[model samples]
Target: MSPKQRILELREQIRYHNYRYYVLDDPEISDAEFDRLMQELKALEAEHPELITPDSPTQTVGSSILEPPFTPVPHPTRMYSLGNAFSQQDIAEFEASIARFLGREGPFAYVLEYKIDGLSVNLVYEEGVLVRGLTRGDGVVGEDVTPNLLAIPDFPRRLPEAWDLEVRGEVYLPLQTFLELNARLEEEGEVPFKNPRNAAAGSLRQKDPKISARRGLRGLFYGVGRPETLGVRTQQALLERLAELGFAVEPHHRLVSGVEGVEAGYRAMLEQRRALPFEADGITVKLNELSLWDELGYTAKTPRFAIAYKFPAEERPTRVRQVVFQVGRTGRVTPVAELEPILLEGSTVSRVTLHNESYVQELGLRVGDTVLVHKAGGVIPEVLRVLTEAPRGQTPVVWPSRCPECASELVLSGKIHLCPNPLCPAKAFEAIRHYASRRAMDIQGLGEKLIEQLLASGKVRDAADLYQLKKEDLVPLERMGEKSAQNLLNQIEASKNRGLERLLFALGIPQVGESTARALARRFGHLDRILEASVEELDAVPDIAEATASAIHQALSRPEMRRFIERLRAAGMRFEAREKQKSQALEGLTFVLTGELSLPREEVARWLEAHGARVASSVSRKTHYVVAGAGAGSKLAKAQELGIPVLDEQGLRALLREKVGQEP
Candidate 1:
């Protein structure tokens, strides 16, 4: 055979074996044999890039280079999230609702499949060739994660036959894999994912596909966007067809005749859930017949034909060893429960936040008390209740009179405790980290370890001190080589020009989020103006609540804050705002944007908001315009059905330019 023919042959063989091992749970060839075939294919492709195919198994390793914020891809059909049913009564009510909607006295046949606790994704195929993979970003448009999707061994690169189709699935990390990944993260001193679902999501969103390949993510095909395209009539038939086409369909699905069958299936799955390799929080029950799906229709957020029967939250008994105080960047003191190390939902549970003083009092919790801890949805370990009272030698939980990190007297404000000292070490550390966050200065190389080093050495006392650091100063820190130190210094210098809004946010003013900062920047046009503005003047700005205004007023009036502002101004930071929009062209209009756009949705929203347009997340009669792009889903359909004005990207841009009489 010619080299091209041999490569094609090898690809087919490898794809078949991948299907056998990953989808069918059977292996026709050893790993060594598969590696040999893959190596030959890779060498051949490297020699002749022109012969390379998108679906080549070699591409599954992903690109060596990383690219952030993957481009958005629209789904052919809306990936509606399922409404949850926590109790048996909720399930019965759901059945009754379906019957009511169908106007039928008899119970409807349904299919029950385990709802994998993972990331929802859609894979599109053209002529039996895998073309694109997308995340379920907003039910309409999603980030194009084709490369990452290909990294999963179970994610098919080609179908059995040449056919156009779209299959929806849950991409997940198995429980064992999740535990190992978290262990590795813990070893690296990096924060581990709270659950398998979060781990799967984080893995799939990695900028480098190679990272995803190592994550051991598996996909289970469950639903079809258009089953008729593949000659499938029922949900069960759809799953079977998908399996035949070399997709991993969850094997535990049951086809039940009526509500009773659904109840039985639910019970069986709940009992057997622990035996499954992956985490499944619930069982999804969908109407069996595809013909009735449309008739049953959908609500705004979920499909009416289906509902998820969630299992009860997993609870375990553990002792609260201590209640410690954590001071946030804004000086708010929160009580945190330090629990005895115990495994919960595949992760080690060591700590849970108490939120505030009121929360601590409400639980009547004390040190050495055995408490019932549970992880709801397999995330956020929380203290459910006190299972056993404090032991005889245990003491009542004491509220600290002063900040632990700094000797500042604690003050009660409403239900929460405040450290009040702006210069508190804990607050300074948190403030510096927040200032360097992506949403603020976006200092790429400045992370927790480096910031901690700077704090300890007294090289940086506040956010402004960051701009003054030199390469020589950073090089001495652990893990900071000369090159890395220089890069960090470069990033810090670049951040000085991030403009007035970002500077306002980076200042760490209490109650001033990005939106409020943007509003203040636009209204005053200069940092000096904002600093000089009275509380009444600040309250007059749009979107600035009275409380927020008061907080900003108090924060800026402090002597320490005034000195900090002066230091920032001395560092050559950009303090003047950008030009304000001259016209309120879309003053009375509200727009809902859906699907892929030339620019990001947030950027579009910001521009529209600058011109006095209200951006609504959903479509309604009140929405004056719907900006629809490629692959626009239910929102687009709803807009057209509701007689709401719809505009494509080009049309929307044109309208904006025409209204403002200038480029946006």
Candidate 2:
């Protein structure tokens, strides 16, 4: 077949696969086979640039080596975040607030929805055809990601007949899909994504439609962007219409006629969050009457009509089976606790991070000791306390004095011990593994198991060695088919072209997370520049501590490290400075999120941060705004007592609007 025809066929096949896998949750072909088809399509498109359509699967990684920073567009309606309620009293106060707002209301009805912990996106459907897709940029304006939106399976390319309207919903990666995607990225010698939310957001924002398409993005329509066009008189009616139109409406959404029912609904959803496939940070409650919604109107940034009830974090108990120490890329040792399997939240818990030796000692944790496990923000699992009555004879696991991989004598730094050996095998392997992870190079088909296999087989010695891999070297490995091997090789090749920030983060520098990496990339702009910085120079950057500076300085000082960086640069790695984007309105402001919001808290935090605000985990005197949603508890009262400005959804919207110079 001609290359043009082949490309078309390949595109069709991959699109079909995306629908089957992402939308239908079924697949006919093996993952390896699927990867091969995508690789073929990408190659064909590369050879014939004119054939590279917006819908092609190869466009997801982004197009153009470097594009201008994303421009934000104003949303048609101000996207309001939710206020949170934590305790029963908080719920009662929310009800009272509703009654006061409506006037002469003993009870008010509310609609409850699981606050999905994913990126918030707005979908504009013009006459039943999906026309525009945008991120909830600054609530008012968002980044245009229309092509990427089309790739999401659940985001209907064409709305159902008789349903031509704009709507808002979350674009999230399901837990299973997220895990699989990360797994694939790991197998190809790439960094694994940090979390599902980050993965989903990063995937959706890809400049390349093809890359977005390949990641299997999905959307769930939750709110009417333009309710008047829908001919719906109430929020309930709008949801019903959304359900009729085959959108993935929240199945548990129920309209409670009074405040009592609203509170109950919020409680029910909070309890069910752990059971849901998608992560829900809180529950959303909207006033039922669509007219009331209009009357309540919106502040510059959010609607006054709805509030989100956040679930209080619950702590559960588990036993520590053993303590395992992991050497990170920069050689800092993190102590991890292997817990006796106990069901917590939604999944079975088997492990928790002790953070460091100091943390372990602070908790008085030892192997065979029962400890309380609680998720902070329903995401990170942490050990709360060790039960003293459990027993005392067990020997405490010794903090490793030497590198587990190369037996290099460990060094003491502030708050952490480190493996000073630049050539520690374990450190090298982990560094290489992290460098190749999804958030880094996003090499498909790479995973921990495969990394281990590669290491054991002596096929890959370091991160730089990944780019040098050949299909022949992989095909001979156990369980690796010819197609799988080639797919991995292709992914590795593609990773060589990833941006500087990703490469920096992938390098697994001590205390350098994705955010830090981005910051560094923005500051230094290149690997060579960062390598040349001294400890003091590194510490001069905001948020970079002395220990982090020392670690970075040490890492850069290594001959092998310098060689690896040079090799990567020689192989076409690119680096560029990121622009420092900041918002002054939220400067010095601390927001205490109580319940749920229309958008995820992270998205809201990002919005606030961009505008110069900080999101604190708990209520404190320093907090400036306490956002109280449906089921807010102690925080709300605390805020009131502290004389901090308390904002319901509408109030918060007003604040944002005022800041942005928009009328509330």
User: How many residue pairs collide in each prediction?
Assistant: 1, 54
RMSD of each: 19.5, 22.7
- Which regions of candidate 1 deviate over 4 angstroms? 1-322, 328-332, 338-351, 361-370, 374-381, 388-402, 407-423, 427-430, 447-449, 478-487, 510-513, 534-540, 579-608, 616-618, 621-664
RMSD of 1: 19.5
Best by lDDT: 1
TM for every model, in the order presented, reads 0.53, 0.47
- Please, what are the lDDT tens digits per residue for candidate 1 over residues 434-468? 78888888999999998899999999987878878
Give per-residue lDDT, candidate 1, residue 581: 40
Predictions in order: lDDT: 0.77, 0.70
Model 2 local distance difference test score:
0.70
Model 2, span 496-519: residue lDDT tens:
667777887777554566666765
Candidate 1 to truth, TM: 0.53
**lDDT measured at residue 24 in model 1 versus the true structure, 0 to 100:** 32
- Prediction 1 global C-alpha lDDT: 0.77
